[model samples]
Target: MTRTAPHPRTAVVACATYLPSTLRTTAETEERLRVENPTLTLPTGLIRRITGVENVHVAGPEAQASDLAVAAARRALEQSPGEVDLLIFASGSQDLIEPATSHIVSERLGTRCAVFDVKNACNSMLNGMQVADALLAAGQYRRALIVTGEVPSYAVRWRVDSREQFLRSFGGYTMSDGGAAVILEAGEAESPEPSGGRGILGSRFLARSEHWGVGTIPAGGTVNPHSEGGAYFDMDGAALQAAFASVGVGLVAETLASIGYGVDDLDFVALHQVARPYHDRIVEVLGVDPERTLLTVAEHGNLASATLPFQLAEARAAGRVGPGGLVALVGLAAGISLGAMVIRL
Candidate 1:
């Protein structure tokens, strides 16, 4: 059944995900941390205990962020073959700073489509969708591809200096390598038949940029490009939790309400998750039905921007969500951004 809307709309037609072949169990991750710093007396099982992260993907040294993106993009296009007018590489990790990673992805994929990069931490992919949707709505592009390759594992802190340093680097323990791709195409304009809407119905975003300091990979930028100190993940878990607490839980609910929907009306929800505790807290506060949301932190760790699309891809595969089903892509980013994008598939 096709949607019969009065105007053209950007529809998410395909979704796919990929993970690196190398897998590191929580035990191995902890052991590596301790081995690298023999003086480290940090407690064991802390990652599994606190984050429920049993395993995370680790890319080989030869693998690049663009490789992951291309892999996922290939899978998505294979699922729904077509030419793309634009490509957006929405990811936290890049192959290099000289050129946008999208260029690398396009070149690898053998596509010369207009390409660029969009970055906003874990919200990168969502923001890319927002941009694609806007452009499609304005008839500026016929179709766009949004892809992400998150390699937070590469920036993980392997050597713990002290308990305080471990606390600051705790977030890195749950880091994983992941890739995802989404295809967005403008639906045909206007039909008079009874309609069930398709594509992005509504989306809302709110950010407290001041929280940017709460989490960072302090190196490779102007501030610490030449220093080893800037090469690993640095985050204050307490500060990030406090920052999100200050933002409250109204964003998703209010966004849905504005679009005339309630939490129960959603068929499936994909919440950006970094850890089990944070995921549980968000689920409880939002009053979302735990059974209906995709919970992945325990298994895949933090997939970063790929989390939402990875969930979406899994839901579709499992029959939890499908064509004509209503779904919500809710995101919580490190820069303290909260958002929800409602879609009728």
Candidate 2:
């Protein structure tokens, strides 16, 4: 016997993004590297050709991850239909190790609501949304604020000894500073169908624990504090690519299928902003129309978890997506986790 689907109870009412004012252009980055390492030689236009990132925003010295998160959250609150009953700070970067950064954001926003943090590297915001959705669906909350601030600029190591070191630092160069927030609220389900309304239709997450070491920050944690060669971001690009090739495409297909939809049913798709090649490959694998998916890596670089919401806000502002559209939010995190959330909006 066929079973009826559960009605969607949470709808994204508003979304906003904040980008730092400081700009770091590819030309400046290359010039600085050349000056520091005179023997270094990179092919002309290689950075732009490979990453497609012309510039990335850098947070000022005074700006912390929580600051950006608060900025974005305030903007979202301004546009929200109702007051926030809960706040979730989801970011890879945190201003402090204790007290949870969400508390700081709530204090800044003057929100007396319950607050907490959810982190999954680049997938933090998506995971936060999933939590909010579940809470709303369970009638535990009426309104929730999901926010992220990614200030990876602080982790970048500008000086490298050799080409291998430089290559290892490439991921840092592609990271930008930014924040994003989305307000989700409980709303009446659409008549006759759950997926017909402006709410999350479904979400799925998959993890490959063995690949957890693919991306990492080698220093600052309790396990390896003050260790040498552990101050900056490092990644295994080849391994990450292989993981995506082997399972990424299949995961996305499975997610869409679970929601009773396919890539073609998506009016817009927002994926993590890694680089040009990864973006292209994801679009190809999903069989999605390139024009329907938004690409911000070229301009904003990788904002970590903030990338998805930033792209969603930008797409809404550009009139590329609107009411009643079906959108898909996809994420690939450093923990070697993959997730997809289908939303009807």
Candidate closest to the true structure, highest lDDT: 1
* Superposed model 1: Cα runs more than 4 Å off: 1-7, 190-196
The sequence of per-residue lDDT tens digits that candidate 1 reaches over residues 1-345 is 765447555789899999998888999988888789888886888779988889998888878999899999999999889999999999989999879999999999988789999999999999999999999889888989999998887788777778898889989888889999999999875433322368887888999999999999888888887856658888999999999989987888877887678899999999999888888988999888999898898888899999999999999999998898889999888987887898889
Model 2's TM-score against the true structure: 0.95
- For each candidate, how many residue pairs have backbone atoms clashing (under 3 Å)? 1, 2
| lDDT, candidate 2, 1-345, per-residue tens | 665664755888899999998899988878887888788887766788888988999999988999999889888878875678899999999888788999999998888899999988998999999999999888888999999998999888778888888887788888999999999988776644535567888788988878888788877678676657756888877787787667755777787787577888888999886898889988887898999998889987888999999988999999999988889999988878888898887
RMSD of 1: 3.0
- In order, what lDDT does every prediction score? 0.88, 0.86
CA lDDT, candidate 1, residue 200: 86
